[model samples]
Target: MIDATHDTNGTRYKLFSFMTHDVFGHGQYVKHALMENEGSECLTDAVTSFKYVNPTWEKVRVIIVEKGFGDISLL
Candidate 1:
């Protein structure tokens, strides 16, 4: 799971759920799978390789519901 948010100040932050699995033992399997692909360039490459192994991997669904600020009213 991934959680990302952008505030009014345009500061964006992201949290990765896999860290918890890593702290435990669940991520060991994932780590091994990533290692199988020796030439992975970055996180995206690892993710792509993982997707190749398990096509049904669960991914967070994000929808941009609203964007941009509305008209500002000054008193």
Candidate 2:
């Protein structure tokens, strides 16, 4: 499973199991977006820019989890 977390600092992503290989394309897309906006004010801004540039690439699925202090589990 692919997991991700976002906070004030930035977005953190991790992939569990070998199935991660299938997600390289998605990762590349995100990387390219970030690279295009080299000096983005925040991660949210970068993502917004990406959507504006590529309107066709919509419907990204993300499982947002709320974790308390010291909690380290995928939701």
Best by TM-score: 2
- What C-alpha lDDT, on a 0 to 100 scale, does residue 72 get in candidate 1? 15
What residue pairs clash in candidate 1, if any at all? none
lDDT of 2 by residue, 1-75 (tens): 222333323443321211112345542223232222223244345445556765654455553323431223311
Off by over 4 Å in 2: 1-41, 62-75
Where's the lowest-lDDT run of ten residues in candidate 1?
66-75
Give per-residue CA lDDT, model 1, range 1-75, as digits (tens).
Answer: 221123423322221112214435463333222222222243345455656765545542331212331211210
Residue 65 lDDT (model 1): 19
CA-lDDT, candidates in order: 0.32, 0.34
Instruction: Give the CA lDDT, 0 to 100, for residue 21 in model 1.
Output: 40
